[model samples]
Target: MTATDGHGLRADAARNYERIVVAAGQAFEEAGSAVTLEEVARRAGVGVATVYRRFRNREQLIRAVFQHIVAAEIEPAMAVETDDPWRDLVSSLEATVEVLAGRKVVLAIARETRALDLESMRRFVATMDRPLRRAAEAGVVRPELVARDLAAVTIMALATVHPRDPGGADRKRYLALLIDGLRPAPTVLPPPSTPDVHGV
Candidate 1:
């Protein structure tokens, strides 16, 4: 069966795959989408041939690299306290910025969403959208805000905070501004509608 099958990779292959993804994430962050596969292999302590065997092309490898990083970073961050909807939303956005800043594969995926066939992207948006809408209804976040608007705000915040200066004062300030902007205004929403129990 192919690697795509549920057969599972061999121990050695799994080790090599992990190394390549870690190395590629760092290289991509430092060099952007132009990072070379040769450098990734070199850093991973594996031969270029092995890297190629695992991922036929740069695009494939980049996708794998991003998936790995997101699993490691983003997923875990979301598991923290989310008792307050507004705080949870801000924390999630901050975590995304941290992950994207250090993973150019993520940046590349964002840049070419049309080409990436990534189901995770859709799932992520849906996950965030639910809480965002709830936060708006609860008067925690702006009623006029949509999930896409929040996503745009995150992208803008990341653009303003350079990767090299992650966690610096400027990054903190930008995050604060983003959180502040998301806060609900008293006059923003219309009256709530009652739930429809019967089919129309």
Candidate 2:
């Protein structure tokens, strides 16, 4: 093959790979991670073999899509700034829950990934911590409330709203309830479902 032909083939392959990752992320976000690889290939406008060649199995493709989400969506959201730290923390928490509501791939990553790149988790928690502490000092959440509660509340409030849900109403309704429920109780806070601060 000519050098020009070789360069074109390489470029095309790279494009195909990108297309597949993008398509897979979109599919997972919309339909959850169980959506078939064939559906991903079709949405990407490539043959099924192309997806399989890039990702040997459904699990690998789902992981790649989660990586894409971390890079593309979560990172940008984390960088968002606002003068109101309380608002910032609350909105980001809600957004995260909304983003992950039905995403089984992310949930799987949360449950299974042995060595998750949790740096983002740490930073996100720090961001939430400052505002949360400020709110607590102002008597919003109880003084005893820790940073983990923010993550716990966000996940528990939204995890039930999967892609199979009829609408976002339930998610929004309960998220608001959970947020307001944080008003300082006279007694100690109850134990949360997951102990780790990071939801994903």
Clashing pairs for predicted structure model 1, backbone only: none
lDDT of 1 by residue, 2-77 (tens): 3542347776788899999898878877777677889999999999999999988877876676566557776566
Candidate 2 wrong stretches, greater than 4 Å? 1-17, 28-39, 46-50, 102-148, 162-167, 181-200
For candidate 1, the per-residue lDDT at 28 reads 74
Looking at model 2, residue 115 earns an lDDT score of 25
Question: What would you estimate as the lDDT of candidate 2?
Answer: 0.68
All candidates' TM-scores? Answer: 0.70, 0.59
* Angstrom error at residue 142, model 1: 3.5
> Which 10 residues in a row give candidate 2 its minimum summed lDDT?
1-10
- Cα RMSD for candidates in order: 6.9, 6.7
Which stretches of model 1 miss by more than 4 angstroms?
Answer: 1-12, 31-34, 104-120, 123-139, 143-146, 163-167, 187-200
